[model samples]
Target: MTLFFAIVALAFAAVIFMQQPKFGKMPTGDRLERIKRSPNYKNGAFQNLSPTPSFTDGANFFTVMREFFFGGDPRIKPTDTIPHVETDLRNLPIDEQVLIWFGHSSYFMQVDGKRILVDPVLSGGASPLSFTTRSFAGTDAYAVSDLPPIDYLFITHDHWDHLDHETLKKLRSTVKAVICPLGVGAHLEYWDYDPAIIHEEDWNQTIALDDHFMAYTTPARHFSGRGFRRNQTLWTSYVLQTPSMRIFIGGDSGYDSHFAEIGRTFGGFDLAILENGQYNKSWRHIHTMPDEVLRAAADLKAKNVFPVHSSKFPLATHAWDEPLIKIVQAAEKTDLRLLTPMIGQVVHLDDSTQVFSHWWEGVN
Candidate 1:
């Protein structure tokens, strides 16, 4: 028995030794100092919040272990597996404004002849290990190679799903500027992006793109970390305002007073894209449940709400389709306009004629 226990311990130690380091110190210099000292720099609001319930309960480990060793629930359906249709941007006139959902929090927004990619993740998996589970439905939609020249790349945080190192490396040269929350530039810089082109903003700080367009880093009730050290960096939601339109991108957040505050400051929004999936009672302070998402949209006084952060990875214990179903029901109860677009489908902001199809129905 002693010999067997010793062998098990050795195996565990070896696994730890073989694991790659998840984080490292970012480069510091005069440039970093200048950015840090800027008046726009605000301390990360969520970092100081009292700890919320754990997202994962103690039973999660055993359940996951059982699933790994022996297949558990197979109810989770695969993601959309249809090959993504690649359209020619050059042929289409650049004046049309369009938004395409690319699963999870990723979206391709074309506005005023400029193209922007938000939280783009094209990797096969979100975990550190390649062998782990992946998106229930395979992403057959456009890969990184299908993207045209990106005018701006916006990131809300450094979580694996939001900030993919491998994808960033591929986008380094093609993207003009990388816009992110404070300290996220460090990760991009480490990945070999031009430090000069990486712009970092703090909560409430606004970056003006032109007279017609601006991006503001808003507060999100969440924590950040690539590994064990939590809150070393900041996480944020974003408010993108243009002369003709206002859009609020809620990166990932728990229900908080900040949503109402944002509505007051912005005088409401035309649309609010919010995280609506991967929630648990254990981590209610960090991730909003489906019902909470509807409440947030109402707090923002948004005319339209689009649910995201689902249909990508199985990070929660709930059934894969629960988030969408709950969100739809909540929106109905709240009298909010819920826009549910298919993966890789385009949404025109100016037009309300398009139908919100239940795309996940057959897929899930």
Candidate 2:
């Protein structure tokens, strides 16, 4: 019994070590130091724009144990399977734009006829091992091969769900350029991505693609790390501005004053893709609740709200449908236009009259 227990302890330690964020040799750039020294570098937004105080490390061991061993309700059965959608890469037209949500923070966005993938994680599970973690309830929507040639890839942070090394390795050859926050390029570099093709930006700094589109690194109320050293790197949201429209992609943020600040700076957004799932009271300040999401939509003065980061992973104690239920109820009360697209459905932003078919019913 003593030997068996010792083996189990060592195994657990090995898992922790594998999950830690591996920082690479620091690159020489002024923006890197500027971001690290900034107060909002670790946390999203400027110091004055933060809604809550900083997080203090506590007894996360109990939290982890409770979640791992005794977390989800067994009454919830695994969702039914759905067919994956394949994108036509050979003859995609330049005028037509579409965005496909591949569950959680992963998305395949066709903007201005250009293909851009954000945080693509196609692994069987979101945890250290495939057998242990709860897989997403949504359909296995689309595989990497089905995707059109990716012109650009954006990473919000180094969290397992947001940045998977396996996904990066698969896409390294095909992707044109990778846009990321400071220090994130190190992970890509480690994965063998060419340094010249990686562009790192600080908060509020803009990267211009052309006269029609530009991307700005915005604020997110969250920390970044895969292991023990938290807040060593930066996390961020993104603002994609086109000639006629501006879109805000809220990577993963708790409710913060920065939403309003972003709105004030950009005037308003045509669409806001905000996180609306896997939230809990224990980390409420890092992940916005349903009510807070509504407030964020209002703060951004967005014409439409597309909720992401939920409907995929069972990372919290809430039921599979809880976030959607709360969001729909809250939207009715706040007069917000929420677009709930199916796993592979294409949403045309110019049209507001498009109907949202309830696709998660069979799966949920």
Candidate 3:
């Protein structure tokens, strides 16, 4: 009877904790209705296009926790401060079509005269608690204040690492509109963002941002949630077509057939910004492995692949620089160019010939 009471008490405590504003609310009312209409939503939650087990057949969360707590690589994080270049995002000339990666999956792009910020987590940490999943030294330099007025904010999903509530709340005033996967708007709405500016969408839907800017929502082999209950919202990738560029905003996805299908549908991307870190064989179905990153890029038919989801936070147990090293090694055997810029270093989209030094080299 005591054990039962203890379990009940813990569960109740968990429920109360999740009600905090930083945790964000799930979809309700109209948003819930819209999510229900999505083809991806199944049973009681959103389903990946492919069968995606959180871990492999044999291993589960306990095994993962054990690995994290015991057998993780020795250099799971960097011994040295991560190298960076602090570009003045507020003063970046609109005439220059470029992208500045703020380490990991967050980036700012100015293309065809529009400023786009994707998954900006500038809060120096990525977990629900400030002490955990902390951003590496010298990587979290660009805060919300440094950014220009955001014309569009694209949130791939509501993972704490991607869609940070604190960051979003800070950015509310400067942000014009949010383009996110379905049901993610609930969080924004709960945070006091005007519902009219939220253009949340499902996979395969095309959003005409303007006369020449079109965004097509696409499938991703991942799940989404900010709290305990998972997959209540959709996870998505995007095929963004500007007046002169077609960029694939691959938020976070495991290697899957969807890459080829998206490539065929949109006729490939000039640059594919794909996740290439925080991966392990245990959760291989959700995060792309190093070797699989190149394959996924090839499948996307990308002319240039920009690897992300690393360098900022140690979300996985792999060595800090493994993703960049492996991706670079993988790219050497292929014809596709790689966009490997330092964190906050600008990559001029017009200048495909611009070379980036092996910045991670020699940095322990």
Candidate 4:
């Protein structure tokens, strides 16, 4: 009887822990009604354009878990402190069109006089539980306190790393508007944000921020969920168009024809920011490989390409420096200009001639 009671107590505690606010509330009421209306929604959850298995052929859950736990690379986490710059974002001149990356898919950009924050996860951990997926040393330099008043917050999806609940809660007061994919607004509303400012969009929909600035929600071959239920919210990429420059924000995607489709539709882009790490053959249909990243850039017809989504968290088994090393080598054969900035390094948006150092070299 005592053992039974102790087991029940433990289960109760686990339930309570999972119910914490950071877990975020799921779509409900009218939000669910709207979600059901989406053409992309079917069989009770959002579906990808292409059939994307979380694991590929011959890959089982138990096998993958075992490999991740015991057979992964030793260099998955950096041994030395990853270097970064500390920029004064709040005080930077508004006219200076620049971008500051905060590592692992989070970045700040000033374009067409609009201040944009994308997929910001500054809570130091990418997982729901703070103890897991922690950021590398010196990479946690930009906290919510370091941010300026944001004109637009772009959340590509609801992944724990990209749509961080703790960071969003703290950023509520500073953000004027949030542009997210469909069904994602549910989380923001649950967090007490004004519904009027949370703009949710479907694939191929366009939001004209003004005559000079427009945002287009494009397709991404990825999946999304906060908990056990998957693909409840749409994952996406974005095309941001200004009077003088067009940019493609490839949030998280696998190699697909959508890159070429977007390139054709938009004509071309000045810059393309794409995911370049945390990938394996076990899940090849979801995350692009290093070589595939270059192909994606070429498909987008981007003049300059910036590879991100690595160097902070150890989400895959590859050596920490492998992505950088492979991508740099692959880029040499292509005409596509690559941007390899350190965390917090400011990149001038309009300057094609600007240069950045290969900061990842020789660092442990």
TM-score result, candidate 4? 0.96
Model 3, residue pairs in steric clash: none
Full-model lDDT, candidate 4: 0.91
Please write out the lDDT profile of model 4 over residues 230-268, one tens digit for every residue.
888889999998877998999999999999999999998
Clashes of each: 5, 0, 0, 0
Candidate 2 structure quality by residue, lDDT tens digits, 76-125: 33466533445554356767767777777788777776778888887656
Order by TM-score, highest first: 3, 4, 2, 1
What is the TM-score of candidate 1?
0.85
TM-score (all chains, Cα) for each model: 0.85, 0.85, 0.98, 0.96
Clashes counted in candidate 3 amount to 0
- Worst lDDT 10-window in candidate 3: 49-58
Candidate 1 regions with alpha-carbon error over 4 angstroms: 1-74, 77-92
Candidate 1: which pairs clash? 54-282, 78-136, 78-137, 79-136, 79-137
Number of clashing pairs, model 2?
0
For TM-score, the strongest prediction is 3
Ranking by lDDT: 4, 3, 1, 2
Worst window of 10 by summed lDDT in candidate 2: 19-28
- Per-candidate alpha-carbon RMSD to the true structure: 4.2, 4.0, 1.2, 1.7
User: For model 1, what is the error of residue 224's alpha carbon versus the real structure, in angstroms, after optimal superposition?
Assistant: 0.9
Please list all clashing residue pairs in model 4, or write none if there are none: none
